[model samples]
Target: MKDMIPVDRKMSTMQDSKISARGVQVYYGETHAIKDVSVEIADNTVTAFIGPSGCGKSTFLRCINRMNDTIDTARVMGDILIDGEDIYDPRVDPVQLRAKVGMVFQKPNPFPKSIYDNVAYGPKIHGLARNKADLDEIVEKSLRKAALWEEAKDRLDKPGTGLSGGQQQRLCIARAIATAPEVLLMDEPCSALDPIATAQVEELIDELRQSYSVVIVTHSMQQAARVSQKTAFFHLGNLVEYDDTDKIFTNPQDPRTESYISGRIG
Candidate 1:
């Protein structure tokens, strides 16, 4: 395992949480997915959600951006606040909320459009750019942030699908950041990548914490230790424990968390 570097050392000052969830609950038709979960995610920090395969980590993650609204049978009940404003309010627009909170899925799902267009899509839809020149700059900057500009710059007009798996994943990340989102949610982003590709994405995730509040749901305990400053361990639809990465991994308070971390139970 690589030595984990502290992200706080790279920042001049600590920022307050960008997201706060209180009594969050989720249901999929008759199944209760998340049970009264609450957590506060700080700005410019990386928070990892970890647990067994069927735990509610992913379900609760979708609540942060209101992504569950797309499912007819999915229901969310809670007060999720971004910047102190309730995102679950009836007046809040899910489309606009998604724009503010970007997501990168488990698999690399880049659009069939050109590399430039894939990154430009979000900015265009959100009106982040005023004209062609502005859009070009946003696209370039986004790709650069995702650490794909050097490889993708010459292939701006090429199909996004033509890129390598890692490149395509980075492109998807570029697409997400293009909207200038304040918070970024990653659902097992490294799950589909090779070790080399996963390392690159992990590095990018650390770098991203300098600007955005990053929340990641990953099954790899090593990954959770490597990428996150804070860690939340979920079990059977319940948030069993949440604390500093070092404490959670080294000195967990909950017996369930200790069992999961020690590989005794999951």
Candidate 2:
């Protein structure tokens, strides 16, 4: 596999990053969620954010695409740059930014629309396809990328919600990638799947790293070790450690990380 290379070496070799966060912090009303966290995410790599519940892992993930801005009580302070451009700049439209940075949630939240329409939603809204043929081609390509085209081909008009849990998640993945995003964010994507389906999604995640930067928030340490090149551990809203996944799991430098990994404390 392409990921066979040493992760530390891979990180050192790729000088360009898809996203950079500097002193990023998020607040929900009186609660300070993320605190002074900063990291660089390389392109075409999978980075996992692992932590116990409510440790700000998911909150920080949302900041990448400015998904946190939707909450009236949420306030983000700090610099988040995508390809050297500050995404929180006044001129950058959150809607347009989301197209470039696609996200899949913990659940398979496919639209109430048909399978075809679900995948085509982003492309249609972004005007990515010029006509019906173009739209069809894009929809096919996205479904194929998500590894769901063959199963759904005969039932394109069926409701996306009608698919099995795993299929629905893949459909959501298709919908996210239809716009051809530069970065893909996933929050506990495999949490709802069975072992077989989880394996499928994990394989798909590895394949996706070839085309886009993938950042995932997962509670499972094993999942982070399996699917991510880099892993960041968060504790009490602070970024405790960030390094190659192997290093983070095998030789974590911080005591907090070690404790968390050793099952001493969450």
Question: For model 1, how does the per-residue alpha-carbon lDDT over 175-245 read when each residue is reduced to its tens digit?
Answer: 99999999999999989999999999999998999889999999989999888889999999999999888
**Clashes, model 2:** 0
Candidate 2: residue pairs that collide: none
**Which ranges of candidate 2 are over 4 A from the true structure?**
1-13
lDDT of 1: 0.91
Q: Give the TM-score of each candidate.
A: 0.96, 0.95
- Estimate the TM-score for candidate 1: 0.96
lDDT of 2 by residue, 138-217 (tens): 99999999999999999999999999999999999999999999999999999999989998999999899889999999
